[model samples]
Target chain A: MIRGLVRTAFFVAFCAVIGPAYAQGPLQLASDVFVEREIAKPDGTKAKLLEEPKTVVPGDQLVFVVRYKNVGTATASNFVVTNPMPRAVRFDGTADGAELVSVDGGKNWGALATLRIAQSNGGDRAATSADVTHLKWNFNQPLSAGAEGKLIFRGVVR
Target chain B: MDNIFAFRRNNRPARNHRLALGTSLSLLLLTVSAPAFAAGTVAGTDIQNIASATFDSPVGPVTIDSNTVVIKVDELLDVTVVTTDPGDVITNPGQTGNVQAFRITNTGNGDEAFSLVANTANGGDDFDPSLQQIIIDSNNNGVYDAGVDVVYVAGSNEPVVAPDQSKTIFVITSTPAGVANGNRANVSLLASAVTGTGTPGTSFAGQGQGGGDAVVGSTGADAQASSFLAVQSASVTLTKSATIADPFGGQRPVPGAIVTYRLVATVSGAGTLNNLAINDPIPAGSTYQAGSLTLQVAASPATTLTDAADADAGNFNGTRIAVSAGNVPAGETRTVTFRVVIQ
Candidate 1:
């Protein structure tokens, strides 16, 4: 009877230790959207700056940054980040060359040059950068504990 | 005052293959391609974005969504003006109520009102015309009507136009008196945004539609176009005089007196007169002498022409003498002389 009581206490201690971890998950994420601006520098040169888009208009270039961190104790494997394109903007390519873009709303994934969009007339045409509807980055290696990084892409307001 | 945008937390997993096909098909219907040179997204539109990350853990694969970020679009103020008339309007000296057509287009991304101004008496023209009234094409028929079209008063009926919409304006002016023919007159119409105009990127806070900020575009929110008025005055004048000689070499109006009648035709104005012909009917108490028609042009000697319609520019058809002077240049004179015996 004493051993049975000891087992119950041990099970209660395990539940208490693992309960918060399961609820909060192991990965933390944050996202930010900014508008790109060009300002003339003091020495007759121009510099590009990413500023909060308080007064964004159509045809303005935008930068989107997504940050992810592995907060759990163990390493995380097959880490993938996905971002859906907003309806009010058109994809203008990304500085990160490792991104896989989906022009058909994540149904098909490939480079922008290798995709085609289906037309209403039963014919398909090559997809341009503006036709991208989703962006993704897949890390083949496992993410170590407490590892953090950011991914960036650009778009133009439609 | 609300500069901070609240983010939304999305708890859905990433890369749901089962829903990808259906979601893409529906999204394709909403993906209408917008022109690259368009006025852009509507002002005050909220553009939201949310990203998700997935990874394999001891508790299996898990997905976590980042907070949504939003950006609100602002208003862009721009305008364009163009003259739609074919060419310069032709006018005569002291002409009034001439109409010049112009089109004003709002190329910005918000609904805006514009103030209209018409300026006459621009330099480099031969004369200055006076402004009569400014009319707007209220019916959008492109033609000006006295009662149907709206006469624009200074601040009273400014047109609130939508983006990419155009308003036709008619500037009425009166040509100045004593203006020379072939003279040119220039008139201009300027349309400026009622909100304001300045250098590009000038901002007006809380003045845009939906209480958003308004920024001036490349056109500076103001545009002007000019219309030309060309004076074309043309006419012809004629004078006739008679010299009477009696049978005894005395100048008297007697029954047997010979009357020499001379007709002077002068072409005036800045344009040539075509098909110019003068007709003089024989009086009731006179008899025309056969082969008595004489024709003279400018400073050359007079050449006697046959009174028949043969090989000459003169003909005596039945009762009157006709001279087909053809085309006479401006500021030129022609003379026709003939003799008659009084009854």
Candidate 2:
């Protein structure tokens, strides 16, 4: 079972070109990607932050920032954004304060502690940074034309 | 290297060679000696599979799973302790600063730190002696020179025993200020792969970057027993016989008769025969039966064998048999038997 979750690595998705069974409305999903780092404010506060990571070593803190915008003219409802936690890092928690759900390449979603993957020893171990195979964020609000929102989660370089 | 959580015989190469070589069936023998960190090979830790995040968007439950993220895992941890000498033998009133040598190898897939311990046989046959200290052969030379080798202190172990790399270690014992002539001591070197410092309970620390969680093996200990022998004495007796049962139904050998050869080796002496290897070849005019070899000892009933190296008990490849009778304690007996068909 854990191997199933582990295979989530190097995962690739195939897209099916459904010939215009019907003229489906346009939905343009544009995205922006950046790497963020928290910096300290001159006032002795760590409020100031920066982006762009040139190099990173083990046990370093890194935040992934991805912005998604719906550029289509019609409104897009129930837009769910999923960011497969990078293999090199762990999905510790949400840095953007958004409610989140994690999966071990399975259907169940819950707190990281409640999730488990099959251990090699014929037992189940609670999910860890290594166990969390994916992360998801739900935007219940509708996205009108030209509306955009940011989805950000915090992870540590393993 | 076998299934981490599965049951298997524990054939550790500890100080007791004979005992260590005793092989057992994987299912019948389940020794919780190996750490549970190892699993489905190396690449499994870094899952390359992808995740799916779906939500309703009119067309269907669209799962825009994030890009495939192969979770990286830390390096695995493992270690082994061994010695070249068969067994150390010395007379009582042993000299101070007397040293025995050993080597600890990092058997894991990643770099690891090992903490060592040298213990003396608390109390046994005659008496006990004092243990000065255990040292790491920093210079790679076997000899233990005060300044050349660094003394092993509590809480401080080897810095880095790289994967597949070995480091020499020495155990030095000093004769007490005033001691009796007949005294003994058993010293062992233990190597524990240092765990990483992470979510202590959640996952293994001490793992290579992007490696799996940490779980140290039971322990890798190679013992060096220091004896104060009043006299160099050791005697091992081997007695073998063949019993035949064939179409004739009598003890006499016949064309289709199966010959079962049984040999009992008994040791009676103060000194120990560390490696009691039993070698036998198929007799002439007879064809050797494969997988019919086995070892049995009344004292240690649990140690059984099949013919394989990883089996530990002993190994035979039809033509010849090489069984390792680890360390046969005084008054202990080991019995090995095999079957061959008379041509």
Candidate maximizing DockQ: 1
Model 1: residues >4 Å from true position, as ranges?
A1-25, B1-37, B237-343
Q: Can you write out model 1's per-residue Cα lDDT over A1-158, one digit (the tens) per residue?
A: 44334434433554477652221347767667777889999999998766667677777889888778887898999999888888778988877678999987688898888899989999999999878888989999999999988888899998
DockQ of each: 0.31, 0.08
Interface RMSD of each: 10.6, 16.7
| Predicted candidate 2 versus true structure: per-residue lDDT over B26-119, tens digit per residue | 1111221212222212312432223233334554434333232223334544566776445653533445676767788765545667777675
Alpha-carbon local distance difference test for all models: 0.80, 0.54
Please state the error at residue B49 of candidate 2 in Å: 9.5
lDDT of 2: 0.54
Candidate 1 lDDT tens digits, B200-230 = 8898987877667888889999999999999
